[model samples]
Target chain A: MRLNLRVWRQKNGGSEGAMATYAVDGISPDMSFLEMLDTLNEDLILRGEDPVAFDHDCREGICGACSLVINGDAHGPERTTTCQLHMRSFRDGDTIDVEPWRASAFPVVKDLVVDRSAFDRVIQAGGYITATTGSAPEAHATPVPKADADSAFEHAECIGCGACVAACPNGSAMLFTSAKINHLNVLPQGSPERETRVLDMVAQMDAEGFGGCTLTGECATACPKGIPLPSIAAMNREWLRARRKVKG
Target chain B: MAVSGLIMLGYLVAHVAGNLKVFFGPEEFNAYGHWLRVMGAPVLHHHWALWIVRIVLLAVVVAHAVSAYQLSRRDLKARPTAYVHRRKRASYATRTMRWGGIILGLFIVWHLLDLTTGTLHPGGFEEGKPYQNVVDTFSTWYGNVVYIVAMLALGLHVRHGFWSAAQTLGVGNARRERLLKLLANTLALVLTAGFVSVPVAVMTGVVS
Candidate 1:
């Protein structure tokens, strides 16, 4: 299916960017969204034109490397990652707009690629559990409740994609930060630093210049992993509880 | 913002209940107004309790407004660029929160001037006769228009504000989401209807 694309193009982080239009023909209906872009890049290379740049690694959707707000919706109209979105979702001759995530915290590095190291810093703040590395311990030694395990796994699905920030009108990273906090904060193994985990992570999140949560639910809607909106409330509960228990 | 907003929401519940006393006629309504000033009676001096409440509400309003201003500024700064292809996102009430809050703040000034201070009252500003003062204010067309519009804005504000406050306070969850939303909607509908009833009664000569 042939498609008209309006892709955001930027030379580097310091330069300004704008949408550049291109018409690509003979696109296969079965091709993934990234492959469709590959077709465009190939054509551009044949003509010695500068090909569009974007972020993508594990094209399998789990790596969270692919970032694109296709047609105003993060990762396109599909709920899955951009790599998983196929060309069949669009009709022939459709004009699709592609842009990088727009958040001050995640500034555009190049065309359709933004700096996401803010997420790394948030994770560094607190996203780990204490464990002995000398030898493997018996699974029975640290018994995790079924409910806690379920909740942890649910939050563990977050891929750090930054779609939440992209979709949030306030560009808040509350969902992403909350997901990381809850992933470890719920488990028995994560009990030791639970208080510091939430406190430090939230502080780091705020220090990163991310906006506060307004409960808009846009972040959860844009999330590919389906992180529930209530996850944020859970994190807030943890933060408040920690604040009361551990006075500054 | 959440704490201040909840304080204001609680005040609104009591305010609406008091406004509903007007349906009972001038005597009961006037007595209720007098009771507000002398609420604590011998325990606290006359108008002292009212003054306390006024001061607390003033502080809450200032806190709420300051936090809202800061939040809005940060929100705008966070998202510096706009999406070229923008689609409407979130519910209508959710999107209008900022503007709705400003409307309520402005309405509070007018409401106090017209009813509490009687400075903006169309007829002679009479003290100790709140029932008649209320009627006089609602007697005019612009009074009813401004009041009804603000009340509608109030309903929308509370509808989103209550649910949002619940979430912000960490009281919201999947199991309680439905219950919280229902409660928010009920409070919004009840408060709007209660306050609007006063102006409607005056316009229709039901209480005049």
Candidate 2:
């Protein structure tokens, strides 16, 4: 299949960026989106032109490293990560517009790459269960209810891909922050710091300059892991409960 | 923003119920209007109850607008550069929230001036005669135009705002999502229809 691509090109974080058009021919239908980009890059290298820059690791789609907004939709028209998106999702000779994740919190570092360390800071704020470093404890010692365990596992699917921020019109990180909060907050092991977990994480989220949730559901829609939109409401409940229980 | 919005929603529910009384004829309608001022009469001074409601509503409106302004500024700032290949995302009601809120705010000013204070009433404004005052205002084409447009904006605002408030307050979840959406739609429709009914009645000479 042949395709026309309009890819974002930026020299560095401080420089201006624009979409540069390229035409790639002889693309295979089974080739993943990133693989298709590889073909384009190989052609660029053969011509001694600077190849387009993008983020990708664990091309299997679990690393949360691949970030691209294809044709105005995060991860292209597909709901999966860009690495998992195949060329068959598009028709032959179709033109695709590719751009980096757009959010002030996730500043564009280069062409299709944005600095996502803000997510790391948010996680550092609270996304953990405190316990002394020692041997692994017996599973029976901390019994978790089936329902809570299931809920925790559900939220644990979040890959921290930043697609939620990319898709949200307000560029809110509520979904990602909420996912991490809920992942641990639901388990019996996570009860020790439940109050601080939500309160501190939300404060860190706000401090990161991320916008507030408007419940538009864009984040959930773009989420590759299918983290439901209600995760945000659950987080809000935790935050409010913590605020009431732990007065400052 | 969520708390203030819900407070205003509660006020709107009562406001619409009172507005429906206009169809009962001038005596009944005017009496209801008088009752608003005389509510809690024996226990409280005259118009004191009304003043209290007015004060609370004024405060809610101020809070709502202030937070909305702050949230909008932050939201816009959070995304300094917009995507070049923009596609339609959320529902129309969701997208129009900011502008719809502004319209409703402006409509409140005009509405108070037109009827409450008799400052912008097209015809001769009379105090203690809300029944005729309503009719006089609706008699003008622009009055109906402005009112109906605002009411439409109100419907859209409430449709998104009610569900949004539930989420913000953490009262909404996966199980309650359907029920909350239904309630939001019903509330929006009922409020818009009830308020718009007054102007429709006046224009049709049913209340005049």
Clashing pairs in 1: none
How many Å off is the CA of B43 in candidate 1? 0.8
What is the interface root-mean-square deviation of candidate 1? 0.7
For residues B108-184, write the lDDT of model 1, one tens digit per residue: 99988998888888989888898899899998999999999999999998898899888888898889999999999
- Chain B TM-score for the candidates in order: 0.98, 0.99
Give stretches of model 2 more than 4 Å off.
A133-136
Interface RMSD of each: 0.7, 0.7
lDDT (10s digit) by residue, model 2, range B91-156: 999999999999999999999999999999988999989999999999999999999999999999
DockQ for every model comes to 0.84, 0.84
lDDT of each candidate versus the true structure: 0.93, 0.94
How many Å off is the CA of B187 in candidate 1?
1.1
* Candidate 2 Cα RMSD after full superposition onto the native fold (Å): 1.0
Q: Say which docking band candidate 2 falls in.
A: high
